[model samples]
Target: MVLRRIFPAMYTAKDSEPANSKNGTLYLLRCVFFMGVRKPPKRYFLAYCLWSFALNLCSTFYQPIGFMTGYVIHLSEFSPGEFLTSLQVAFNAWSCSTKVLIVWYLVNRFDDANEILDEMDKRITQDSERKRIHEACSLSNRIFFFFMSVYMMYATNTFLSAIFIGRPPYQNYYPFLDWRSSKWHLALQAGLEYFAMCGACFQDVCVDCYPVNYILVLRAHMQIFAERLRQLGSDPHESEEERYEKLVQCIQDHKTILRFCDSLRPVISGTIFVQFLVVGLVLGFTLINIVMFANLGSAIAALSFMSAVLLETTPFCILCNYLTEDCNQLADALFESNWIDYSKRYKNALRHFLHNLQQPITFMAMNVFTISVGTNISVTKFSFSVFTLVKQMNIAEKLSKTEEEVENLY
Candidate 1:
């Protein structure tokens, strides 16, 4: 009886092995080749561009509506009055449009450059490993473009629409639709912002980690070239001059890799600077403006949560800059480390790191904000679960200070 009960499990495993083994190997091979699987097709590229353009067009049309509506409404309604309200509306529209344009243009340029790099790298036929690197670069660029395009477009569109469309902003004036504390609107806002957070986190992961992987590949190439040089020198028939020439060529390739590292520095630094400055100014201004009219406590809670997110993300952005700089310096020193017998091990370690690269750090980061959805909150007081969660954890003190400074401005 026991054997009969166990028979199905045994047979299931027996029957599954051939198919599972073949499929698993195939899947592993694809992952080994591409590092990450291929992204959606090229048609998605054109669709993304068009979607951004459409979003910009929509925002531009509605800017006038927000301005006109705020103007027609009496000045006394808003705490700062009508002129200030209209100005904030117009400014928000302009700020949002600018953000969309900036994100769109930067992401587009990175996509083009990464694709070119991948093609160039693909031509290096030392082994399957080289091909895998190129394919990974290509796939990562595609994924980055997809995430950023979706994030910037949707965020800009939602923000613009909320601020400008009809009475939402004029009535709520929440800068964002803060429905998490509102029973009627909680579910919808949660779904939307959760998507937004996912995209944002994914973009951050790609921008931060892609270069690190590429740097690892370059380091590996350096080590391999060093080995080849040693082998050439050891050969009984090889000429000293030939060995020197190979060494020179290897050094040149190393320099080329360094140049790629240098190129990424400005991209990383500029992204951090521009994103922080723009988000900081816009968010600070919006929160202060909102507090002037709405429930001050609710505004405080909402703005505090926003600042927490902005601050927590700041470290990742700064780390991107740090990695870019560190990689350049490290790439230079890695060649020198050969004398100490550390170069080979270092290179091997980097390879292992690259092998485990796509481990969902981005998805995990999004959980900071995502899982807060539908948690216990005070609907009457308009406090959010996000605020409670972060407060309990005591994150983002600098962000809290900045929020206070901005709030004081109002």
Candidate 2:
């Protein structure tokens, strides 16, 4: 109920309901851009296509233009700190574009995603321990939304700092090389950047949140299923046949959850892979820039960028870890169930279910790397290593210059 209150459109079963029935950042986006149209209207589709094209084009060219102009053309004048900062910004923009592309690919499957959510809701609400499940879902939603709010504040601060405090007049901080000759032109460019950035952020948050919500719901259902399995033989009045029937039902439920996870994987896998890749570079570059740049504005920008990257990557890893753990525990839960008292046929079925559970049910990033807390740790370590290497090179370069000056003085 609390989940429904917080995310009515997300939790609601009816697709026909007006998008305005729910009110939240993500729900509003859905209402305006994605909801109710199995096939988006031609105008809407064209608008989305054009917007995505512009965003991707900016992401694609921003880095190369900056590299050529700042590093190649003016190599002697380019400070290492400035170069790293530019690189970080470019990577951040590219990451945002990747998020947009992922959402674009997945948007058409919004109805299927909703059906999974609706199924999960129906199953949980009908469970015997519905209250506990509801509480868990509520807590999860609260934590998620709280993180999202914090991220929004951080993004806003960074955006404002970049606009008013960091850049010179007529020189926009966006990756573009174009000159805005007038205040109004600069304002318009900034506005467009804001719009594109917000759209990218919205898409990333919604895409990540949907899978997380589904994982939480599936976890609740699995818990209930395990409990039901354990209670199968507790009721002495129930006949063996009835118990066996319940066992079959539990098996069916387990299969359904697995099926749901399978369906959800493809929608998120490539996005997750790209996120991991981009975040690694972003984190490393941000760290290098933060350490090298002593100015307040640069520090704030780097910190903000780092926070955004961590917020995006950390929760997804945590949720994936939980999802994996919940799935792996299924076998143990089944074994704990009162299966000994059931007939041979029922035990056989239980054994088969347990066998199936032994195969890992995990979310993969592009089917290459598994999404887990372990992977997050590895990525952090790698990023840190990169930062350390860069720092050492910087120190060595300064030391070499100092030695040359000392020799000249002698």
Candidate 3:
């Protein structure tokens, strides 16, 4: 009832098309056959598991860097005696959360899936002139695992070194701990933590969002195709019978596509909400802890950066919402009365819309994540790389007529 009210233009004849028997049978066969392939190499799998463990350790070990740096930045001087205790607590918590996320990513392969999916999708679409998607798909796992290993090892070692030097900051905060350490260690730790946090966030984003973006593209493709079919027979002078048959066929196809989309939505939506809850809870706890123990500058910086990460992630959330809306939008377009005319050029419009939708979603989910990782993790070098990539994409995209053409065509 609510849907009907909001989409008054979207009511169409109920479609009850039989499932694609061939594709169904083939899907089952493929799954069964592929299930026989032995798991990825034990060595590689072990490496990844270790990588995840180390990442969490380093993240935990050097967690205080952000707080330290923030405090230093705000004060323009280091006061190890004041912030040591708070830094310790912050570092420990950060490490634990970072580890948990690493474990989560590894166990579920959510991040890995996104990377491979993006690579595979781009190879299929953007690189269509050269390589086959089949080849691309086969190589995705290899490339991702290689990249993951190199990244995790370097990140882990860097943080560990930072921790070794900076451990004294905590001791300094509590004179009772009775440990002596140099001020240089604290300064070094501060620098290391900032760089490390960036790495963790950037890499994690790359691994998770790319695949979701691919799925979004797939959804757009189906919607565009349905729209195309609807336009094939649109004619004002056509008899009611002819129009009815065309609409009926289009409805049937839409239902088929819609069912597939509906089946997948639960997976996408569930994962998204779970991540949101987890991130929110962790950040909330961090905030409360900071308020209770830490002073203003450190607390503000931690909170501000956390807020920035969340805000940066806003595009992804919006993309998810847009996908759901697209489905219903197509449903509404199906039932439009004036849409019966071929002269409306609905098919062409839909193709353009589908293509246009893919860009922002892809940029937010894949490109943004990659850039974020580089910037967050490698502040000295890759930070600028991420920034430059994002800046370039944004500027080039604006200057280009692709979006404008698509909108006008649609």
Give the best candidate by TM-score. 2
Ranking by lDDT: 2, 3, 1
* Candidate 3 lowest-lDDT run of ten: 18-27
How far residue 317's Cα lies from its native spot in candidate 3, in Å, is 2.9
Residue 323 in candidate 2, Cα distance off native in Å: 2.4
> Per-residue lDDT tens digits of candidate 3, residues 122-216?
32222222222222222333333333344444334434443554443222222122222455655554444545454454444333333333343
Query: lDDT scores for all predictions?
Result: 0.38, 0.60, 0.39
165-237 per-residue lDDT for model 1 (tens digits): 2223333222345453564464454344333333333333344334333433343343443343334334446
TM-score of each model, in listed order = 0.40, 0.77, 0.39
Against the hidden true structure, what lDDT does model 1 obtain? 0.38
**Each model's backbone clash number:** 0, 0, 9
TM-score, cand. 2 vs. native: 0.77
Q: After superposition on all CA atoms, what RMSD does each candidate show versus the true structure?
A: 14.9, 6.1, 19.0
The list of candidate 2 runs beyond 4 A from truth reads: 1-38, 41-82, 108-110, 120-128, 166-182, 395-410
Better candidate number, 1 or 3, judged by lDDT: 3
